[model samples]
Target: WRRKNENNNDDPDPIPCIALALALLYYFRLPTNEDNVQRNDRSTPSREEFGDVLSKYIPGFVEIIQNELEQFVNTDHFVIPHG
Candidate 1:
């Protein structure tokens, strides 16, 4: 999910987010821009087309992130010191 900061600006600029996402797709060796080729025989997938591809992996990604957060919270590093 793309998030906006308090001021309504993209917290992490969209370009890098898109680049990293594409890189992950490539790194995982999944069907990258080929998804578009299958759908429309295009070299580049439209945002919606690429999004459809990424959506499939979102659940697993979110679970990994959630688990990381859970583990982090359970560790002593999460403690806040008070006077």
Candidate 2:
């Protein structure tokens, strides 16, 4: 099936990377005495949360995802943006 084409075998993927990064950033982003809401109930992040991560922790990471999605719209990679 599709399993044969993968680059790495039995490897952890982006889930843990993104999750741990967010958790660490979240822990540091809290106010000195404030508590974060329980994360168990919030499986999916809100758009604002994604924007917050992009703005505070990792900029252009989101834009990288955007370009990935845009690839589906235009497969011709040679297109010039300004021309």
Candidate 3:
């Protein structure tokens, strides 16, 4: 089964999509401006907003990340030692 993007674009390989999601996650975690960001000045409410966003999306995305990690380990591409 295949899922279509909201704009009706079909992507058979979703790996890039997941990679972009991870990049977005990092972008959101970054301070408002540290040279990479267009917006400058980190404020209290901006930090709060970032937290709110993480709380909203992290749970769902975490599962997706976990599945990818499992695939890596199963394929021997990842060798994470047990603690």
Most TM-score-accurate candidate: 3
* Order of candidate numbers by TM-score, starting with the best: 3, 2, 1
Q: For candidate 2, lDDT tens digit of each residue in 1-83? A: 01221477665456334534554576235432212234443444454455566655555554544544465347475655665
TM-score of every candidate relative to the true structure: 0.26, 0.28, 0.32
Q: Residue 50 lDDT in model 2? A: 58
Off by over 4 Å in 3: 1-16, 19-59, 78-83
- Cα lDDT listed for each candidate: 0.50, 0.47, 0.49
lDDT of 1 by residue, 1-83 (tens): 45334465746445434445564565344444656667775555454544455557653443443444465566476665665
Candidate 2 collision pairs = none
- For candidate 1, the 10 contiguous residues with the lowest summed lDDT are 59-68
Winning candidate number (lDDT): 1
lDDT of 1 at 35: 67
Regions of model 1 farther than 4 Å from truth:
1-59, 80-83
Candidate 2, residue 46: lDDT: 52
Higher-TM-score candidate of 1 and 2: 2
Better of 2 and 3 by TM-score: 3
